[model samples]
Target chain A: MREILRLIVVLSLICGISAGALTVARLNLASRIEKQSDFYVRGPALERLFGKPAEELLGNKISLPIGDHLYPIFYLTEGSEITELAVEAPGPGGYGGDIIVMIGLDLRENRMVGMEIIQHSETPGVGSRVEKASFRKQWQGLPVDEPVELTSQGGQIDAISGATYSSKAVVNGTNHIIDLIRRHRDDIMAVIKAKGE
Target chain B: MTLKQALVHGLWEDLPPFRLVLGLCPALAVTSSAENGLGMGLAATFVLVFSNMFISVLRKVIPDKVRIGSFIVVIATLVVLVEMIMKAYFFPLSQQLGIFIPLIVVNCIILGRAEAFASRNPVLLSMADGLSVGIGFTISLAVLGSIREILGAGTWFGWQVFGASFEPFEFMVKAPGAFICLGIILGLMNAYSRMRGETFIQT
Candidate 1:
C-alpha cells in the first residue's frame, strides 16, 4: 500500500510540473506572435493607406464571405484610378503539401501586380525554388485574360527545374484567384467604393 | 552496463529507427531536406534527454498500472513546449515542419526508451542512454536526408554539386521516393552487417 501511494505521488508531481511549464511557454509564444504581427502591420496597413482607419477598412471582425472561401479584402485609395485587391489562395497539394499564396491584383488593368508564397513545405533544394524571387517575378504584370502556362508549354514563365508539380500547383492556384476576381468584379468594386463613402 | 556499451548499442544494436523502428513518422515525414532532418533530430534529442532523466527519477515511485499514460502526459507536455519555443524563435523551421512538430508527442522512441531502459535505470545512466540514442537517430536522419537532397535536386546544402548538364531525378523528391530510399538503405545496412559476420535480425 505504501508503494502504491508513493507511485501516485510521484506521477502527480511530474504532471503538475509539466502543466505549469506548458502554460508559461504558451503565453510566451502568443506574445512573440503579437510582436511580429505589429511589425508586419497585421493586414491593416494597406487599408490605412486608402485614407480610411484600419478598422473601417477591414470591415467587421468577421471576414467578408466569398464563394466557398472567406477572403479578407483591404481597400486602398491611392487615386491612381486602379483598385488593387489582395487575395490568399491555396495551391493544390505539392510534393510537400498545399502551398499558400498571396496575390495582388490590379482590377482596372486586369493584371497581376505580384504574387508571394506565404507558406510551403516543399523540399529545400527542389520545391523551395518556387519561392525564389526569380520564379515569382515571372508572374508580375501577367494579364488576367491570358492563360498562365509553364515554359514547357511554351509560355513565358519558366517552371522551377526540379519542382514541376509544385510550380504547376502555384500556377493553378493563381489562375483560380484570377477567375474569382473576374467573376466578382462588380461586388469587389462596390466594396471599394463603400470604403470611400 | 558500461558507458561504451551504451554508446555502441545505440549505433546498431538498439538503433531508434532501424532496430526498434520507433519514431518512424517523423523519420519519414521531415527527412525531405537535410536542414529539416537536422532540426527535427535536435528537437527530438532534447525531448529524449529530459524525459529519460525525469522518468528515471520517478520510475520507482510510479505505479505500473498507469505508467504508460503518465509517461505520455509528461512527454506530450515536453513536446508542446518544444513546439512553442521553435515557433517563437525558429519561425522558418517551425513552418517547414508544420504538423510534424506537434506530432512529436506521439513519437514512439522517447516512450520506448522510458519503458525499456529509463524505468529500470538510475537517472545518470538514463541520461547517457538518451544522448546515445539521440545521436544515433540524428546520424540516420542526416544520412537519409543527404541522399535524397543530392539525388533529387542535384544540390548539396543548397549549393550546386552536379554539373549544369545533370538533370535531377524528379521522382526522388516525391513521397514515393521516401519509401524507396528508406528500403534501399535498410537492405544495404543488413547486407553490410551480414558481410561483417554480424547477425542481422530482420525486424
Candidate 2:
C-alpha cells in the first residue's frame, strides 16, 4: 500500500513538470510561425491568392466560427484582389477522415488559381494522392462561374488514380467554398475595400 | 525494476502499441508524415516521462478510491502544458498536430502507464520505464509514418525519393491507410514474436 502511494506522488510530479515544459515549447513555436507567415487562415489558402488576410479579413482566431464549424484562417496580403483569393478549406468526412486543403481563387477571372492539400488523414497510396501537385494543379484556372465537378460527373477535374472518394471530397469542399463566396460576395468585397479605407 | 528491464520492456516486451496496444488514437491520427510522427512522438514522450515520474512520487498520497480521478487530473494538467508549449515553440508542428495535442489527456498509454506502472514502481524506475515506453511508441509511429509517406506521396521526410514520373499513392495519406498500415505492422510483429518462440497474446 505504501509503495503504491509513493509511486503516485512521483508520477504526478513528473507529469506536472513535463506538461509545463511542453506548454512553453508550443508557445514559442506559434510565435515563430506568426513572425514568418504573412497571414494565417482559418480554413484554406484561398484568401492568400487574393492578397487578403483571411484571419484579419475574416476574423478567425485559434477557433474561429465558420458557418457551423470552428476554422483556422490565414491570408496573403499581396494577392488581395478580385482575381486572387488563396484560402484553406478543410473537407471533412473524406474517404479516410478530414482532408485539409488550400484553394486559390481568381474572382476577377471567375476561376480557380490552384489548390493544395495542407494535410489529410486519408489512406496511404490510395486516398492521399489528393496532396499531389499534379492532382491539385488540375483545379487551377477552373472556371468558377459553373460548378467544378469531377470527371465522374463529367467535369474538367479528374479523380485521383485510386482516391476517387478523397478527390470527390476535395471537389465538394471547393464547390462549397465557391457557393459561400458567391453568397457573401458583396460582403467580402466590402470587407476587403474597408481594409484599404 | 532495473534500467535494463525498463528499456528492454518498452522496446518489445511491453510496447505501448504491439504489446499493450495503448494510445492507438494519436498513433493512428497524426502519423501522416515523418515530421508529424516525430512531433507527436516527442510530445508524448515528454508527457510519458514526467507523468510516470510524478505519479510514482505521489503514489503514496493519492487516495485509493479516487485514484483514477487523480491520475486524470495529473495527466490533463500535463496535456495542457504540452499544448501550450507546442503552440508557442513549434507552431507549424503544433498546427499540423491540431487538436490531438489536447486529446493526449485521454491517451490510454499515459493513463495505463500511470495505473499499471507508476502506481506501483519507484520514482527512478518509473521514469526509466516511461522513457523507454515513450521511445518505443515514437519509433512505432515514425516507422508507420515513413511507410505511409513514402508510398503515398513518393517522399520521405519531405524529400522526393521517387522519380518525377512516379505517381504518388493518394490513399496512403488518409485515415484508412493508417489503420491498414497499423494492421500490417501488428501482423508482422505477431509473426516475428511467434518466430522467436514467444506466446502471442491478443489483447
Candidate 3:
C-alpha cells in the first residue's frame, strides 16, 4: 500500500514540475516562434507575391478564425489603398498528404497573382515538380470564380505528363484558396476597410 | 570514473549510433546534409547533458520502480524546451529538421544514460558523460552529413565543391543512400577496431 502511494506521489510531482517548466517555456517562446516561422517559412513563399521581402507585410497581417484554424490574412497595399489579399490553406487529397498552398489574390483584377507550395511530402523528382515555375506559372492570372481543374476534367490547366496526382493537388489547392476568399469576402473587406482608415 | 574518462568515453568509445549502437533513427533520417546533422546533434546534446544532470540529481528521490516514468517526464520537458528554443531562434533548421526535433524525446541516449550511468553516478560525472557522448554523436553526424551532402549534391554545406561538369549521384541523397552511407561507416569503424585489436563498440 505504501509502495503504491510512493509511486503515485513521486510520478505526479515530477509531472507537475515538468508541466510548470514547459508552460513557462512555451509562454515565453510562443510569440517569437510564430514570428520566426513567418520569417523563414511564409516569408520566402510569399516573396514573389509581395515583390519585396515579407518583413514589411507583417504589420498588415490579421488573424482570421475559420473553422478550427486561425489563418494569418495578409492584406497587400499600394500606398494604403488595399490592392490584394494573401493566405495559406491546407489542400487535401495530395499524393502524399495535405499540401499547404500559399495564394495571393488581386482584388481589382479578380485573378490569382501568385501561388507557392509552402510545404509538401510528395515523391521527389515527380510530384515535387508541381513546385516548378513551369507548373506554378499556370495558376497566375487565373480567374478566381471558375473551378480550377485539370485538362482531363474539362478545364484549362494541363497536368504534368507523368505527375497527374500532384498536378490535380495544386489545382484543388488553388480552388481552395478561391473558396476561402469568396466565402469570407465580406468579413475580410470589412476588416480591410476598418484598417485602411 | 574521472571527468576526462567520461568526456573521452563518448567522443570515441561509446560514440553513439556508430559505436554505442543507439539513436539510429535520427542518424539515418536527418543526416542528408552537414548543416542538418550538426543541428540535430547539438539539439540532442543539449537535452542529453541537461537530462543527465537532472536525473543524477534526482536519483535518490525517485523510487526504483517509477524511475523510468520520472525520467521520461524530465526528458520530455527538456525536449519540448529544445523544440521551443529551436523554433524561436533556429527556425529554418527547425523547419528542416521538422518532426525529428520533437522525436528527440524518444532518443535512447538521454534515457539510456539516465538509466545506466546517471542513476548510479554523481551529478558531475553524469554531466561529463552526457557531454562527451553528445559531442561524439555530433561529430559522427557531421561527418556522415558532409559525405552525403558532398557526394549527393556535389556541394558541401550548400557551397559547390565541384566543377559544373560534375553531375551529382542524386541516389546518395535518397533513402537507400542513407542506409548505404550508414552501413559503410559502421563497417569501416568495425574494421578499424578489428585492426587495433580492441572492441570499439561497447553495446
Candidate 1 lDDT tens digits, A1-197: 98778767877887888899888878768878544433344344334223345554444222356768765554444674436666666777588778777676776787777777766777767898897888887877889766687789887778888799899878877876777677876777666566556
Instruction: lDDT winner between 1 and 3, please give it.
Output: 3
Candidate 3 runs further than 4 Å off: A50-56, A65-69, A79-81, A89-101, A117-184, B199-203
**Total clashing pairs in model 2:** 104
RMSD of each: 9.4, 8.6, 3.9
- Stronger candidate by TM-score (1 vs 2): 1
Q: Write the per-residue lDDT of candidate 2 for residues B24-142, one digit (tens) a residue.
A: 98988888898898889889999999889878988887777667877887787777777666655566787688778878888999999999999999998999999999999999889
Sorted by TM-score (best first), the order is 3, 1, 2
Tens digits of per-residue lDDT for model 3 on A1-197?
99899989988999999999999999999999888867777787777876877777767787778889876788887876778888788777778887888888888898888788878777766888888888888878988777788989899889988888888877787788788888988888788778777
Give a tens-digit lDDT track for model 3, residues B51-168.
9999999999999998998999999999999989998998889878877887899998879999999999999999999999999999999998999999999989889999999999
Provide TM-scores for the models: 0.63, 0.58, 0.82
- Of 1 and 2, the candidate ahead on lDDT is 1
The candidates' interface RMSDs, in order, read 3.4, 6.4, 1.6
* DockQ list for all candidates: 0.29, 0.14, 0.63
Which candidate ranks first by lDDT, i.e. highest? 3
Task: Give the top-scoring candidate (TM-score).
Answer: 3
Candidate 1 per-residue lDDT, tens place, B77-149, comes to 8888888888677766777787787788788899999999989988888888998898888888877777888
Model 2 is docked with a DockQ of 0.14
Q: List runs of model 1 lying over 4 Å from the truth.
A: A1-12, A36-197
Per-residue error for A82 in candidate 3, Å, reads 2.4
